[model samples]
Target chain A: MESLVLKDISITLGQNLVFDKLSLEFNKKVNTSIIGPGGSGKTTICKILNGDLKYNGSILINGIEIGESNNYLLEKYVGVVLNNSYNKNSLVIDELFAGLDTCNLDYEEEEKRVKKVVKYFKLQDILEKRISSFTIQKKYYIKIIKELIRGCAYIVLDDIFINMDLKEVKRIISYCKQENITIINITSEMEYVLETDNLVVLYNKNVAMVGSTIECLKEEKLLRRLGFNLPFLVDLSIQLGYYGLINKVIIDDRKMIDAIWK
Target chain B: MEIILQDIVCNSTKADKCLNKVNYTFKENSINFCSGLSGRLLRDLLTLKKQRESGYIFVNPNGRLSDIGYVGNNPLKEFTCKTVAEQMLYFKDNYHLKYNNVQEKIKSALLMVGLDESYLSRVITSLSTSELKKVSLACVLFYNPQVLIVDYFEKGLNYKDIEYFKKLFKKLKIKYNRNIIICSDNISNYLDILDEYVIFNNGVLEVKGTNKELYNNVIYKYIEEPHIIKFINLVRKKKGVELDNYIDIKELIKAIYRDVENK
Candidate 1:
């Protein structure tokens, strides 16, 4: 079943028409990353998904058209972490669970969930610390993945990788995959996006490309024109193929190393 | 223009020192990149401060001269000028530098950083991520300091903008003899432009050397071992081609094509 569906979506911000007839469907248990340039409406799409921004076209969740009736319902299902920094003074890590007390989930049950995610993110050392003292990047580290682990049906992250290290990014991606959380990560970094199950390329506020990872990588000219960096592994694989060193282009470094050794 | 740090240590509010007696000297009139993991305290060491420590940072140029600049991550917060033009002029007026035309200077700075001239009149709050970054860079460029300390150099720039900024840095160094100290987690992105690198791990200065030497060094085995470097190494081993240190894909392609042509 499709977890989220955006059909012929169009968004206009101020004098700019950000998205033009863009359409895409995200399936449950599949991690999807949206790749685009800086101002290519990737954030607009995420806003539409989170119901923060209104669009002209249709967005359906579980075959139910998204509108007033389902807006609040959708909030329970979708967890979002935007690109901007978050400032949460007078709040601590334990207080986060206390605030979620009104969400109807039992305190003990919520603690287990929070503890599980906190440990996963290696936040055990700073669990009692105030949110105000944490760095902008650390605030994101706790907020983004923790909310998703607390039973949000869909996860949406925008440019979270910009402030993150490679190990943290890899851990977050791996956690999203292990949890079977339907993730829609929007990033300008192609290397980070290539780790996703599917890729959506937005150019000039339109859906220029959409397909598997390799399919998007194969369209090097289009990717270049969109100002997206090609993944180094993909470039290496292509170079090897160009030099007749390898017959098949492999994106996984381990697989490529195995092929070369063989 | 060389910035030499000897026994530099910065402590946070809780008495936890982010930088622990770190020491290194960045080459003059050249790009020096510092890369490490996020939350690894690289930025703190670069700026010589923690989260709470915000005031003036002293940039020692060689042994005899030193200059001070306001130290803050968000440049927009540091500016109090009412208009964009006023802001550029304010920096010039206070610094006592004369430009041919204030408007032209602002326009050139915006264009050099890949921003449209139409944004000059717009409020600073109205700018996009990339635009805001360009404006910050413009402020730095306008100051034309002997030494520039940049944090997250390519944070919000697209691929084209990254290339543009790379070329802009080279031009700035050549034309104006400006020295840049860029702090980022991704070093390969600026390998072509950088003359030296200073690796910071856990607030301690681990290694400082040329780009090639750092690449060959085993301490940075993971971060510096980019695929391009591996591919270049592979070509050198397989075909005995002496590739340049800054061997990007385009350069690799040209080298391969040349080899084929000669054969």
Candidate 2:
């Protein structure tokens, strides 16, 4: 199984010791939510994984020191797809696909991969249009497809769904699950946390709590202390769970109601 | 100002009509939500990357561009000042306000957005995403325009920030009688705050009504049903229980509790 490990990571930003001796491990094929308020080093962690930031201590994928490797070697070894928002004025669909396969020497293979992804996303109509001209939902779909073409088992989205419709967000989550992509959402949105496989709560530059979704959902006190805006459905479902209307905190509205009825 | 958009057709750069004769009246002092605006109309509403085509957009007391306060989805890019204090003074100076008592005005403006005086010295680049959003809103609110248009209103706000905004928007609506127009995809977050919703699907005006009226009217592309409404719907559909349309979870629980007791 694929796994990413951060051992004894420490980073200093100006006067703030943002991540001192921070350690964590993420196993493959399990989507995780890194939930935290602003200034909790969540984006910094994403930056470090994307080889954009220099930090002390070792970052390992399959037990290789990623921090010490050169960019050329790191490109082949690291496959974590970083969520980079498309430059609207500069990007069209074909250009975006070409940009994604930058490391490809085989043109035909890249073309095939692009075709497969385009078919999967049903991007026939607006493939030639400037991405900026498309709706916000279509833009999100394009970005996700571009990232998936990178052939990464590990996907990290750095708060990309802030402006997305909730239904589109759900579609992305379901798509990730179906494709067996180990997606990591680094966000401050509380509504997003309930849908993940695991929850990593970061507060004040440290791991406040890390557990399965069920285990973390019960940590309402910790969520409150971390100053997260708990989702309405999650709060209501938990309350109903206390009253025996639910056995687990079901994040899906229909499923939760079905559980209650059953 | 009461803004009227009649046959307001907006076109993308490629000359595709996105807003197909959208007609709506944004009444003064009302909190209106314009959801699912196409890229073209969305841009024209915020005066961004696109322009409007053959249409009539009439607004009284809005002769100058400064009369419409549009805080965009990502307003952080518009911040050119080094620090929050400078940013505040920059907006104040635009209104021809003197340097005297500028510090007091800046402080009060930051406070109105739930930002502390400490942020005055903080670098604009160093501010968090949420803080940047608030500062942008503060600068726009400082202008106190006749109509306030917040594009993607709840993009980066947490619950506490949203709660703070709810109170502030209420004050603006009730006391100052300022027309606040918010455009977002989801209405669930603004369940309690919004007065009415005007939906824009694809390029046309689909519906303009209250939350209750629009709940069952699911012809639009992006309309979020409140959790209570959805839950009550499930109970009614499955268990044959007739529950009145309750918007709050507490009220739904009370009705559910009564039903269980009677059973």
Candidate 3:
């Protein structure tokens, strides 16, 4: 029942104020997505979560202050895979096991973890392939696998799904959910938000909206005003609602067609 | 300008060649979208940034090579200068363009890309990813080419920026009568604006057709169909209602409304 909480967070880069006195909470074991316009501080929040940037307020992971916690504690609680590129020369196997080398796990335990993750993801074939040889989707898969092996409770995906198809992204997210890992996805792609359990909308350097994924999406007007276009189905349902055809956001094609006909 | 490729074999050294004997034509003043993992390679080859392993590319209206402007995916890496003005100056010098007023030329190019004179002195390293992309695009616009090539519209760009670029590209195509070729892995990004679709998979040309043509063709087997297409298809198959294939959300909404009202 651990939760990731932020309180009175304020940060600025150079002359621009990115986030101002922002506060939010990510319920553990819940897959959450953060979305906003460009320069709206989505990446800044990811950096704060990973302890990569200096900020004014407190970030609490399972009631431990992130600022005071050591790297060991932070690593145990959170794992981050930013959208930035990985070293092209590194092999997949080496990338997967590099984090575990710091975990103090026994050699046998490390192998067991690596083997389980590789088998789970069906990544056994690409273990020897260099990162450069793999496609964008495969590279992200390797990064997620590496984090899975390290055994972090919460994994932050920073808009890495832009290049990946919706089906592929859903498969990976569903698998992570099955593994009982909290997935916090920071993204600009509104389509990916439909897959997460919770949704956080940031706008003008503050939290604009936060609620269950579908509920937040139902506020189509606010989403648009904040410089975000709702996903196709959601937008369709909203328009249909205006015409007195459908009542709620219908993401599935069959269900939506059924609603219109019914 | 029209670009025709004959038996194009690119990136031959790689296990999966980016293009395998691909024969395609990018029509004049048309929007072409090359979608797949090897899209970057295809774009590089089209822009002459990289040499093809083996191929015969025929660009109609000779001297089209100088007329093709390319904006790559990673804009930060596309620059070598310290500031925006310096970069623009270097491009002007490198291209050896005869600009009567260098300052006026720089200002106009930046303005075209939605930036202004204030951005000229800004350091390239300090600019945001979106700004860098704008600057990269400005560098290309400085040349005022007849054909424009842009790569990866979605990566590092937000919804607003993508929409802006989409509108800008459409203006360049329609108003200016310029040919545009966009290379992206996700076809959904340019589904509405694109006139033709050239899909590649593992360095092989899977299919090439107009948006409407490919919607009913076997293109679905290679790439994920847009949600609007999927919805339209479902309505056609299950409910026996034929809806026009509309990529734009607003148009699709209206079509759905009309269909529901008729029902």
Candidate 4:
């Protein structure tokens, strides 16, 4: 069964229609990245999945309708990391762990799980620091992966990489893949989006394209018409292919080099 | 006036050390680029509050350096006002006294950032990521500081908005004689606008030079050159077309269109 499904979703904020007739399905074990320019409804889609925004369509979670009684049940399966500042009312990392302890999971087992994730993301030293003292980037770094570690089947991160370095982003990607957690990464950078299993392109308040990363890149002209740029590595690979140096267009440098040498 | 720094260092408990023995100088009325990771280090440097040694940080004769503007990495979290008008009023009330009209200042700054004036009255919480970035830039431009420092100026901006910022920065240099310093990880994005470029690597000042010198010597080989330039060179080998270097698609399109028209 699909983990999550949105049917003909439409959302309007004030007088501006942000999403119109947008439909998407998240498979059971696939990582998807939503790519678009700013104001292309990436965050709105995440909000809809998290039940933070109201939309005019049907949303299903594991073949169950998303209503008041089942919304709390849905919360247990989904984790979200918003782009805004986190709550900063003198909460420590231990307190956050304690709060999650009430979810009826094994305390010792969960502690081991949390420590593994913290070590993976290299957040051991700042684990006891106050939320107010942490920067915006660090706050999301702890919240996003920790939520995923606590048995959440799906994770939604909203441009959490804008302030991160390339190394940090790679760590997050590896963590998601290792945990076997379905992820929905929202980003404007084409390089980051092309690393995922599927790509959903949002443009002009509608679904412009949805397919594999290579398929989306193949429609570079159409994507640019919707106000998005092709990934730098992808474009370079294509140019090299034109020069008969490469046989395929991709974002991986090692793969491109191998193809060229072969 | 020129801003110079020698043996500067900054460190917080979260990380071991951010800036270490960094030395550089910003010439008078010049655009300087500081590229590094996004954190307190870059933010502190942009606002001219990072640790530094003896140096002359000067402002223009008629310019004032009192106002400090912060364009955060996530622009949505930068603003605290309820409405866009209130956001403009917050800056005007605290920083500037020359222009008391909040709407006019908001309109002008929005136009400078390539945003429509009709967005002035919208609620701050309702904006998208790109729109939020433009609004944050608008707030900074509204203050009209002599020394304008922007952090990660191209983080969420599209190509059109980037071009608009380049033109607006040039206009500010001409009209108000402002000295602008922008910090980012991607230095090539601002190569056209910056007069000088500096890279912060491993908590030290790695290199600093003019845009042309740095591009020709250090950056060109590291980064992939634009596709159209590569295409033009590949197609026309013997008699090549002399195309100007551009970091954007619009300029490349214009150059190609002109070449085709001449043919």
Candidate 5:
């Protein structure tokens, strides 16, 4: 699999070392979550990926150099979906569909594509509603649709799920999974990281742990020492594993429930 | 400080009345929350945007209007100063306090929000969203306000930042006897930290009780519960595995272990 890879990246922001020889890789199609506490350089990493911040290392997406790619073209493949404020004045549907080509397809074809993207996020019911009128929870979903329409494969969301509860975010996870979109959720919330395929934990400006979500969370004491608690399901699954009720730490609720049933 | 809103009738431009004969008495030195209400209604309560039809909001008798501090909902817009230290001094001036300890208070305020003295010199516009929020919180707490209102206070904050705020607010209530009232739709995030929840239904005071008291109430019916709570409820409903008194992840894990052990 072609992967988004960072090689020996280092960054210093105004005397603070944000990253020090930090290296990580993400497959192009798998969901990854980067989580850490405040001042842990989650946003800084996002800026570097989004080409807003300069760093002294190599960032390659499927072996294409990130620094050399044109801004407009670079964004299409490795775009970001920032947590746009709910009170933004621009109409969202118009904004999402603004930059596409108009050379060949007629209005109906474009509208059909828009409708498909809208249906992907289940926004068919409220596609015409004003962006300002949406509840705060739904606003992030709109950004996801916008990013998909903008053709961003490696989507970086730093704080989009800050206000979203776990249940709401899980639905978004399913959507991303079905679309095979590579999501890098950069935040301190364990909710997203627990649901994602890969987990990257940051602490003291370095990668503390990197593994599959279930495996990394199995470092329960280490995570707790870093001032974070595991997700309820992960913790429970670990405890059940200790009791020999389950053979391994399972991330799925249905699997764990069925295991317990057996 | 205590806030008593009695028989309050508030009308929206589109609707006849959003708040209908609502009544609530927010007590002193408590961590209070109001959920299931529009952010507009909650903002109006915290800000007093419009006049009530035939009711009154009674603040503590000796309370100066300046003592009531609001932290969010365009904190920068309400700010008059361009820098951090000056913001605290402005609050000092507005409160008509003696200027002798203004700098000291500014330092203490910044420290309260986990910012150091160096942050006082930084330009407000250069601060991050989390930093701005902490700065706003510091400015409000700098005045030693008896009653503090946090409107969607956890906005733009990470989980650890929220924990710091929870600890600080609890300290403020216990040590200084200050009232920390949060008006947020994200109730589950603050569920563990809140001492009491004041739920609103159709702008009326639907229920008011401690966290345990309000947990099983129908008010949580509308909004989603926190994941652990929902998980426990689901397990109980589906597998007949009833866990007892889960406040957080650790407790829930223990409860599950005990259940599985007994089996």
Candidate 6:
């Protein structure tokens, strides 16, 4: 299986050392979420993974340093969906096909991949509409679709879902999982943490905690100390677990109800 | 002052109706949340930033354009000046408000928003996201508008910041008599603080309800129910246990403890 590894990475912005010798590993097809408070270098990590920032250590994907990876291979293996500003006058169709030629895929394969994602997202209705006409949430969806059309193996989502509706966010996440894309979501919102397979908590420019989502979440005190708003159910479960109202930390509302009433 | 939108219609850039003949009233000195399809359009109309295609909007008690204060998602983008003092002074100059002690008034405004006088000299860009948001609120409170619209209440905020803003909004409504309208599609964030919810679906007013009224209302059909509320409803439906509509997790936990112990 393809895996992404960050070995002893360090990034400094001017006088401040945002990250110092930070190390982490993420495997393919395992959706990992990195969460931290504001100014904790979450977005900086995204920039490093996308090869947009100059850092000290190497970022290896599939045992090869990302810096040495060919343009086509890099584009195919990694994609980033940041809330970056884009040209509003461009049409959705143009935005989708803007970087199609750069991908290693041939003409027919590229068109097929683009068509599949467009159809899945039901973008046929607004393909001709200017990006300026769509809402901020819709624009994010379009950006995600643009990345998905490239058939990216590892997609790093940089806090693009905070402003979106939760239901729609879950739907898109499930679709990405079906396509077996390794999702590295960096967010301040803890509610989306429950949807990921693994969790990475950043504090003081380093990894404070990292484990399976549920195992990492069980340490409520550390996460709280790290300045995260625990997901509602998680918080309630921990509270109830303390009171012996429920046996275990139940993340789902229905299961918690059953555990309580049983 | 109450904000009443009467047959208010807003069109998009393509001339399509974004807010279709919307009629709603945001009561004075209360906390209100507007969500759904045309929520942003409604925000623009309330601020008079976007001209309506048809109908009228009435801000009662002779409220003018300056009476409406809007703070969007990113408050840093709203700043034209560099320092906190300059932004406050710019508002004073732009509104032509004459004050006997302008410096003292600026300090007081900063304090009111939970910021100290030290922030006055700090550059706006140097402040953190939450600090910038508070500075933005301070700048808005300088004018002391009746209707204060905040877009995306819990986006960048942490748990403590969210709790802080909740108290601040309550203080704004109760002590200051300002109407707080938070424009966010996420209903979960406002469970503890929201007084009323006005949801729009497909460019039309879908439903308007108070706190308890939305516990089992049509709002859930469009938007997902908040986790606490969903659990409460599940207990009521599945186990035939009627738990109080407790917005606080602690209170709900206490109630559950009482019920489980009594059994």
**CA lDDT, every prediction?**
0.68, 0.71, 0.80, 0.68, 0.73, 0.80
Binned by DockQ into CAPRI classes (incorrect, acceptable, medium, high), candidate 3 is: medium
Question: After aligning candidate 1 to the native by TM-score, how far in Å is the CA of A166 from where it should be?
Answer: 2.8
Q: What value does the lDDT take at residue A118 in candidate 1?
A: 75
Best by DockQ: 3
- Candidate order (DockQ): 3, 6, 2, 1, 5, 4
In order, what DockQ does each candidate have? 0.34, 0.41, 0.55, 0.25, 0.30, 0.41
Per-residue CA lDDT of model 3 for B1-263, tens digit only, reads 88898998876434334677888888988899876635456556766888987888888887644487878767776788999999988888777788899899889999887889988988886676667788889888887888888877567777777888889989988999888888776677788888998877767778888867747647778767777777788888998988887777788888878877776
Angstrom error of the Cα, residue A228, model 2: value is: 2.4
Clashing pairs in 5: none
What TM-score describes the B chain of model 2?
0.88
Off by over 4 Å in 6: A14-16, A68-76, A85-87, A99-101, B13-17, B37-47, B81-86, B99-135
Quality of model 3 by C-alpha lDDT: 0.80
User: In the order shown, what is each candidate's alpha-carbon RMSD?
Assistant: 4.6, 3.1, 2.3, 5.9, 3.5, 3.1
Please tell me how candidate 5 rates in CAPRI terms. acceptable
lDDT of 5 at B75: 66
Clashing pairs in 3: none
User: What is the per-residue lDDT of model 2 for residues B141-170, given as tens digits with 9 covering 90 to 100?
Assistant: 766677788877566666667777878888
Query: Global lDDT for candidate 6?
Result: 0.80
TM-score attained by model 4: 0.80
Candidate 6 per-residue lDDT, tens place, B171-239, comes to 989998999998877788788778999887767788888887768658877667777888888899999
Candidate 2 recovers a fraction of native contacts equal to 0.34
Alpha carbon deviation, residue A125, candidate 1 (Å): 3.0
Worst 10 residues of 6 chain B by lDDT: B9-18
